[model samples]
Target: MAALFSKMLTKTDIESCLCIRASPLGQLPFEEGQRVNMHVHDESGQEWIFSCSIEEDENVGRFVSVGWLEFARFKEILT
Candidate 1:
């Protein structure tokens, strides 16, 4: 499967939300306001499903509205 996008995890990403850069918006298969299932997997083959909403911000552009904190906790990511 092709990757929709990828990002290097930052402090904000682990503590807050995942931001999708505006430059790749045009290449995304989904549109703004669409809800999509985000499948995330770790190196050990552990997987998690996150129901996310695609949203646009006036200042930040587009981002995946997901329960990032929950995922971060599961992955043992330190804040």
Candidate 2:
């Protein structure tokens, strides 16, 4: 049970952290409406703890990024 919880929470952390790093204009190469999933762990010793891609917004530069919780729901809707 703990392991399952950890996995779920890990994704949340990654998403939260990424949102902080993404541009407000959404111009950082991520598609406006695409969902990205990646493992975020600090063992690699890099500034970036994970990798991501935005795969779908019509106006990539205009779509504002939301918090992790909201983005998760948005991604679900996109799918």
Which of the numbered candidates is closest to the native, going by highest lDDT?
Answer: 1
What's the lDDT for all of these models? 0.71, 0.39
TM-score of 1: 0.65
Alpha-carbon deviation at 47 in model 1, angstroms: 1.2
lDDT of 2 by residue, 1-79 (tens): 1231112234534445232324443345456466555443333543222344443344433332333444444346322
Question: What TM-scores do the predictions have?
Answer: 0.65, 0.24
Please give the RMSD to the true structure for each candidate, in Å: 2.8, 12.1
Local lDDT at 39 for model 1? 81
- Superposed on all Cα atoms, model 1 deviates from the true structure by an RMSD in Å of 2.8
